[model samples]
Target: MELKVLYFGMIAEVTGCNEEIILLEPNSNVDQLENLLKDKYQNLQHLSFKVAIDKEISANDTLLNPNNEIALLPPFSGG
Candidate 1:
């Protein structure tokens, strides 16, 4: 399955980009994707973030589909 991912705040800095299209295995969930991304970019493991499924932040291993729009977000900040 293929999914569109957006990175926000520090996540975008770590990844060096804002958006990406990922090809994932069928039935892959947040945890699996997290691990996969961590493996691909070891620096990502050092930062804390949440996985948003279609704009909703989730901590559970929610199932993802090709059409799903996902995002990696760091804690928001305001001055």
Candidate 2:
């Protein structure tokens, strides 16, 4: 399965791109994708971020699918 992943703020800096497509095995979950990213992009392993699925914040156990849109967002600050 392939999912579209969006990167924001510092996460984008670490990834060196605003978005990309990640291919995963069938039935993969958020945790698996996170681990794969950490290995693929070493900088991500040391950065702090949140995962969102189809525009909703999700947990590590959240199941993933080819149709779901994923995003990695850095901490936000605003008044």
- TM-score of each candidate structure, all chains considered together: 0.89, 0.93
lDDT of 1: 0.88
lDDT of each: 0.88, 0.92
Ten-residue segment with the worst summed lDDT in candidate 1? 52-61
* Model 1 clashing-pair count: 0
The residue-by-residue lDDT of candidate 1 on 1-79, one tens digit each, is 8888888898999888999887789988999989988887799999989999888887667999888779998977699
**Residue-level lDDT for 32 in candidate 1:** 90
- The ten-residue window of minimal lDDT in model 2 covers 68-77
Q: Report the lDDT of model 2 for residue 72.
A: 94
lDDT of 2 at 19: 97
At residue 56, candidate 1 shows an lDDT of 89
Model 2: how far residue 42 lies from native, Å: 0.5
